[model samples]
Target: MTLTLTDETPPKGFERLVRAEDPASGLRALICIHSTALGPAAGGCRMWNYARWDDARHDVQRLAEGMTYKNAMADLGLGGGKSVILGDAKRDKTPELFRAFGRAINALNGSYYTAEDVGTSPADIAQAATETPYAVGLEGGQYGSGDPSPFTAEGVFQCLRVGAKHVFGSEDLTGRQVLVQGLGHVGMSLAEKLHAAGAALIVTDIDQAALDRAARGLGATVIAPDQVFATQMDIFAPCALGAVLNDTTGPQLTAKLICGAANNQLAHPGIAGALHARGIRYLPDYVVNAGGIISVAGEIHKAGPGYRRDRLAGIAGRVDAMLTRAEQEDRNTTEIAADMVKEILASANRNVA
Candidate 1:
């Protein structure tokens, strides 16, 4: 199906370019949202063969907005934005396609920067970098670029430790059973941490290679993705896609804690309350997964390695503080975390103007 782009999306406080032809690569393009509230907008460029244009639009808008909040929460001086290419990643990838993407990004005049996301890789970002110097997360030990997935995993692992302390009143995962849904880079890293802490690990992924790796490397029990939602584990870690929590699956979860690297995990606004009703503690996705953004933000602003490390370590500590506040105030962790993020963003806005 040919997906057409509409020019009428809330004005977005920026520009939206939808192109079909390119001198570099011939592919459908949608450069969504450009915001200058903080500084230059930086976000991942996700490539996927969407079932519809609307799906692509939703992904770009939601992800761009998530990036905005993610950066704001991390105290990064970057606005949020995202780009999406409609085509099969495996079948339609080509130099021409990426080159065209580079050109599109180049036209943005540095208003938006691109990075790697699901279906997009560092190699792809490198290809796009060939067209524009604004692209980030390039491989080859580039000076200002590094893959953010591992950092994302590190943050999630730290948040899990915090969750354990708040709910179980201990940070040790020795006897805890964690069901990690999605054995990708982030998920596998988180599982390794859990294993290192002597926790029992159960992992699931659609890719057999990932499953086999988890089983071999971490001694994780591989299960089907669907089983993760209903697994009788202490923690349900979702390191996969977004919107996994909803009416259907929220009430069915048997895990005592829900924490992972996935962004925008809640299907809707009320899902947090649903988890609360079931006595399930949910670590807010945006707050917990801000590690990658923090790392990248440091690099972009030339904050140095020590600053980045301090920032990453500070995530675990902040998670601990948030959890403690939640328990002390008899409030849900998600609510308290969101309030913290809101205050941070508000402070940032004040600083900016």
Candidate 2:
């Protein structure tokens, strides 16, 4: 089947959405650039076996916009962009496929820079680098940041500390209960951090191997994936796919706080209000999961070696400030964060003009 771009209305606020196909490698890709107010757009390249072309487009659009907020709030001086390749990560990835994708990125002339996310890895990015220098997160490159997962996990962990402080009057995680959904690289890394901090963990994953490893290595209690939302815990850290906190799961959450590395966590904008109505404090996903982009941006901008460490260290304070502002202004965190991004973007645009 020929994958074609949908004829639906273009995503609001997006500057460009480029769809490409490589017949030779059977590759179909969508690159969405949400903004360039700060600078060139930068985000991850996700590879997944999307069931439909429209699904891939929607995912790319949401993710790209989230990156805009994430970058602006993180003060990265970068715009937002994302690329999605519709294919299975393990079975369909090929050197030719990434090269074709890289060529597509290069065609943008630095309007978008690609890195690793979801189903893509550093090795896959290295393959894309063969065709275009627009890729980051490759191993052994002069300025590459090998894997951003650890950094991202650290950011989430720090945000969890902030949430703990706000909701429980303490940042200490000792003896706290945390249910971490998804044991992928970022999730597993976060589990290790939380465990080391003396937090009891209840973990779940679609991959049995990953789940087993978390149980054995991290001493996490393994639970069925379907049981995550209903589980009682102090914190619910969703490191999995987007839209996990929809109508079905929102009302079922028993956790006091929600903070994680997943992008577009809310099924829709109103879900934020729904979560707030239930007295669950939500640390905005984009603000908490910004470590990956911060790491890659450091390398791209030739920031010092300690840039990632320093930036990650500041996340807790940033989250706290945003939370405090939300409380003082009587608004949900989503609105507070969106306003912050808007101010930054407006200021940048004014300076550019």
Candidate 3:
């Protein structure tokens, strides 16, 4: 009946990791606040059925840390944090469960804010907000940013176009062979955009219905999940999970460019270099996937109309600029992006001092 929350020891760089459990609503959640150096941490609430408790913690830590870089890259005045509920998104979600989770978030005292993510929805966020004012992304009310998936898809679409220019010698995607790996809300929106741009889509997903929809609506060629890495395509978009571009998959990829909305696409530190050595241009995921966060941030800061539009428009410029700089420096784009994020953080610190 009562929510039980315990403060866990975070990893080296993390600020706090809180584990929350509530038998009343069957809620088991972890909220990680990686940093608040910029401002209150802002990120989404993901409800996934992780195989192991360790996996859930790792995912939250990686995602929260990725947000620190992502927010800085987007030029937002906020820090990074993330929360995850361990369960089946489809079968386990309940309004009381989300309210329990919301109480856990409120326990942080505004150090973090939450919205819809991977297995969560705007409707779920509305439930959470009933117990905490920090819940965001509800399109139904004032200052709510609504669903951020379309905005996220837009940002990644910009990266896709800009990356295409450098790799294919043209910005147009007409007839381009693109493999979209994942058909979730953001992934499906991205596929439609690419189909509109005339891209020949090769789609894969665990859900057969989603695959069928893509095939029926967009005329996409459905592929098995096992062949995702080995496929020869112009571009490979990973919209599902992180670390798909690891040592093994990176070498197997025949795609010219890698661009997607998934966070922490790189499995480890050196994977980017290997992709670069193979002459494959890797667009940094965080540098481009900040649209959803920017939308939520507008609500957090309560900026008036057009703020989301203006910020979303800047994603294209950042993607193009990063590409140009990477070419000029002959360095991997991830390194260049990290340096740029560091500069932004340092500048913020200096202004405070």
lDDT, candidates in the order shown: 0.78, 0.87, 0.89
Model 1: per-residue Cα lDDT at residue 105: 80
Leading candidate by TM-score: 2
TM-score of every prediction relative to native:
0.85, 0.88, 0.87
Q: Order the candidates by lDDT, highest first.
A: 3, 2, 1
- Which model is ahead, 1 or 2, in terms of lDDT? 2
Tens digits of lDDT, candidate 1, 1-353? 12233445544445554443453355676776655577778788888999987888777877877777667556567888888888888888887677777777877788888777767777887888897987777655435648677788888888788889878989899979999888777888888888999999999889999989889999998888877666789998998888999889888888989999887788988898778777788988887787777766765676777766777777777778777787788777778877776677577668877
Model 1, residue 132: C-alpha shift (Å): 1.5
Writing each residue's lDDT as its tens digit, candidate 3 over 23-43 gives 989999999998887988988
Candidate 2 lDDT tens digits, 1-353: 23334323557778999887888877789999999999999999999999998999989998898788888888788899999999999899889888788888878888889999889888888888887878987777567787788989999999899899999999999889999999888999999999999999999999999988888988899999888876789899999998999998899999989999987789999998988877789998889998988899988887876888877877777788888998888788898888888888999989989
